[model samples]
Target: MKNYRLERLSSQPIIQTADVQPFIEGYDVLGAFNPAACQFGDEILLLLRVAEAPKAEKGYIAIPIIEEQDGVPTLVVKKFKEPDGDYDPRVVTIDGKVYLTSISYLRIARSRDGVNFTIDAKPFLFPTRMDESYGVEDARITYLDGKYWITYTAVSEHGPGVGLAVTTDFVSVERVGMVLPPPNKDVALFPEKINGNYVLLHRPMVSDIGKPSVWLAESEDGIHWGNHRFLFGGRGLVDTKFEWEGGKIGAGPEPILTDEGWLVCYHGADPTHAYSLALALLDKNDPSIILDRSEAPLLTPELPWEREGFFPNVVFSNGWVRRPDGTIWVYYGAADSGVGLAKLIQE
Candidate 1:
């Protein structure tokens, strides 16, 4: 098989935080990225993960959190004095617990030409349940069985987990609850059922023994998944040396079935957490079998916007769309701050 090259769109950073407003009055929109894309009729829809944080006051760091207030979920800010322990640009360790600098929710944006977009006024999905109190992020959408199934990360004190939701018109959504428990995320469902069972790709993190790697699973109802099989491992599992995607790697968009095999685009991070996009081909019938993979990354952080922002040196994708002419449009998050587009022609 020939290697596929990513052709970036000239009009990059299709969406940015500056183009969006905060959902609440006192908060600020930090990022609008990692969108899940799909063709809806004549237009394309992007389910964006919009990150927001309350305006921090001087000498005090603040984190936005959602909590149940009289049975209604309410957004609030928890402020803390200058941390005596440790703090970073994205997180702060106050006392013994670590908190994110911002909170994320799902928002919908639509475009006619797939470049310019109109983000909705309010959040499309937010932290309603306690499990999602921290945020809901990095959504992957797959149209299967006559419905658009969304699998996203539900973040809270327990860590990131896979959450499911479905919608027919992108208007009314049905929450399908948490399908995969904590310490697992980056879930992407296959576009179709294989051998009468639903299939998906996910990343399960490891801390003690094994390394964080991609895995495959099948479900009879698309909800109760089982038959977990390790698909592949990355670079920096047990070795002391560092390489590309050695820190961790996760599944990106939903696997696209092609003449060659199931094309999968995923992100790999070095020890520094600098992310890049790579490709892999899985066996058509049994996705657990690896057919081929890219030796080098197809997409990396290079652009000014991609190399700087909330999280620097990152290019992460959770969605893409295949055009009728066989062109694949990859929508990715740039520095965890904006959205960028890249094109690829599978030859």
Candidate 2:
């Protein structure tokens, strides 16, 4: 691990809340973070998750409007008085129904140096179907078979699930529908087929049965997935005993293929909800087999920006790009408010 050097690209947030405009007017916050990174024609591209919410007034919180038309639905700006229920920055509970405090969508940002990015004015992906009435978020991009495969988290009344889309040119995207059902997210597909089948890593939340953990599934055509196998990170697992990751864990950037094995970067949280980044290595031939895992976190929230924001003490990543010079650039969300870049170079 000493051979790997980590460098913070900037002290300030790379993509800030003021950089984007909300889709629905009157929304007060612009949280653009948790981007998916990839290389597109000598340029680094990021698909960022942008969240917007109205300022909480007096004793009320604003909830996005879910407009349904011809059985399809879309999210609009709306507000409801805070009822007799629990409320948090991310979600609100009233009358036994849960509502998200903010609505999310995906937007694009391009960069030549990976540190400096120019974000597009409009969103790239928004809620258009009933299943995504809440929003789309945390996209992981993998270029496979000459097309960029995007797997994202879709939230709605139905629940959170994994949705797929394909794009050759970011100008237009083709939706591939929901490939994984509710209580699942954090999906990343392998850049190439493994043993003639597409491999995917996801985290399924089964609250009553067990804590959320990473799992692997196989698909023949990148749509239908099956043959689920538990990979790592759950209560009572030997590898999860570390205090920072004992509560929950999920896959981060798409696994980097190395001569040693498949290098995976993942995020983990403790009971206190402090998130940190960790690394693991899986067998190349059989990704299900764990090769090596870091006993301590690779990165933690120590900076002021990473220790405060929409969600405090969280540093989550959905993407990274490895340069030809053995330099790995990790683009991540710091405190769920802004995007930050970290450089890892092999010594």
All candidates' TM-scores? 0.96, 0.94
Worst lDDT window (10 residues) for model 2?
233-242
lDDT scores for all predictions?
0.89, 0.85
**Candidate 1 per-residue lDDT over residues 122-157, each given as its tens digit:** 988888888898999999999999999999999988
**What clash count goes with each model?**
0, 0
Task: Report the Cα lDDT for candidate 1.
Answer: 0.89
Which candidate comes out best when scored by TM-score? 1
Residue by residue across 117-183, what tens digits does model 2's lDDT show?
A: 8888788888787788888999999999999999999998879999999999998999999999998
**Candidate 2 residue spans exceeding 4 A from truth:** 1-5, 55-59, 84-86, 234-241
Clashing pairs in 1: none
- Please state the error at residue 120 of candidate 1 in Å: 1.1
